[model samples]
Structure formats: structure tokens, C-alpha cells
Target: MNAIPVDDDSLTWGVPSRRVAAFFIDSFLIMIVTLGFAFVFAFIHLMSFGLLRGPAHLVLLVGLIYLAGWMASPAMATPGQMAVGLSVRRADDLGRATLVQAIAFTGLLYLTLVAGVIWLGVALVTTRRRAIHDMLSGLVIVRAGALEPRPW
Candidate 1:
């Protein structure tokens, strides 16, 4: 699909608070799903505690992949983002982000424990309001339906 020029003036960048809320929402959903998988695994193999360890990790990994794929899809947002009225798109031209971009964004987010503080500080100070992952992936999270067509 062709990238369309977005009217910068009309674009409303998602606030940090809203973005944080979305993160928590997504995290909670992922946790519930992982726990369900763990419970099922434990039930299926009552004697094999090792089943929980391996399957739990695999479930989390699959959840992460699902999250990335959801973000990269044409919706350009996850369920959390959708609920919060946020969508992620390429910063260059407000185009939908590719799967690679979505995966990188998710991976960098997991690194927040190590580099998040620094990145958060940078995001707050930047005019574009992009977090580290967003900056690294050339993505922007904006208010859903906020993008407008630019005048020729």
C-alpha cells in the first residue's frame, strides 16, 4: 500500500499516560493467557513439574509473537491500543508498520527493565514523544482516527 502524507497539525500524539495504560492492559491479558496455558499443562501432566516450565515459557513466547503480529496487522494496533484509542504507524509517512518493526518494538519493550529508564527520560524530553522502541523502529503511536489527509 502507498504511504499517505499525514497532516501533522491535525495529528494528536498519544500521551504517555494513555500509552502506559495500554501497556498494562496488554500485559494483564498476556499474563492471564500464560497462566491458563500453565494451568492446562499442569493438569495434563500431574507428575511432571517440568511440563509447566517448558510450556509456560513457550506460551509466553507465543503470546509475544501474537502481540507483535496483531500490531503489525492492518489494524496497526493491539487490543489494548484499540481500547485506548491508539494506533502505531511509521513515523516517516504515517504508513502501517511492518512485522519486523512490530517485533523490534516488542523486543525493545522487554528490555525496558534494563534500558527503560533512560529511554523513558528521552521520550519525555523529545518533541515527537516517541519512546525508545518507537524511535528505534521508526514508528509513532498516535490517537486513532487523528490522522488527516494533507492538502496537495
Candidate 2:
């Protein structure tokens, strides 16, 4: 099999293991935020004497979308990606991904529940180490600063 490049000059794709670690970190962070929102909602529900079911799920969904967009913005990377020394970029220009790509990437991730096994298999075998969501959004996850010459 051909080797994947990791030199300072070439596009240094993030290692699969690191990517998985990043995923877990991001998930945990998201969960924490969701839980916080749930707590607030729960309090509100109690105040209402259980008349309201609460919008924890909706808040979580919106929070996730906001988080993804913020992370993929030109100026920043997600906290988890930063922790893992990784970042997301546009596949074509190696620049920071746009908000649209960020949203689409996050939305596509939900599909993984139904087709995630296949998606994970593809990610494992792909040359660039990108998952289905990455491909669909024309984005790539790479070592942080791997494409530093270009504007973020």
C-alpha cells in the first residue's frame, strides 16, 4: 500500500486515532453544554409545575449547530479540535471552512446514525482520512497549521 504523507510541507492530514479522540472530546463538550441547558429547562419546568415538557432537545440541536458553525469559522477551531492539534479546512483551498460547510457537515453527521458504520469504514480506508460529512461538505480535517501559508 502507498504511504500517507505527514511532512511539514505537504498537507498533513490528521491521524485517524487523533480524529477519534477529537470526536470524543467534542462530544463530551457538547454533552456538557446540553446538560446545562437541560438543567435550566428542568428548573423552568418545575417552576411551571410540569405544565411544560421543556425544549431541551431543541436547545441541544440549536446549540450543536451554533457550536459547529463557530468552530468552523475563519477565525477559530473547535475546542476539541484545538486540543487535538487539528482543524477543519476547505478541501479545495485549504482555508477555513465557511459557515455553510460547517452547518452541512454537522447536519450530515446525524445521518451517520443510520449509515455510520459504512461512513466509518470509508473514513478508515480513505487516502485523506476524511469521513462522509467531510467529503459532502468539501472539507478536510488536518493537523493544525498544516496549511498555514493560506489565510485561515
Best TM-score among the predictions, by candidate number: 1
Report clash pairs, candidate 2.
Answer: none
lDDT of 2 by residue, 43-132 (tens): 888988888865645774854575576667765567777787877778776667888888888878767746655676677777677788
True-vs-predicted CA distance for residue 27, candidate 1, Å: 1.4
Error of 2 at 3 (Å): 23
- lDDT by candidate, in order shown: 0.76, 0.71
Off by over 4 Å in 1: 1-10, 47-53, 116-118, 148-152
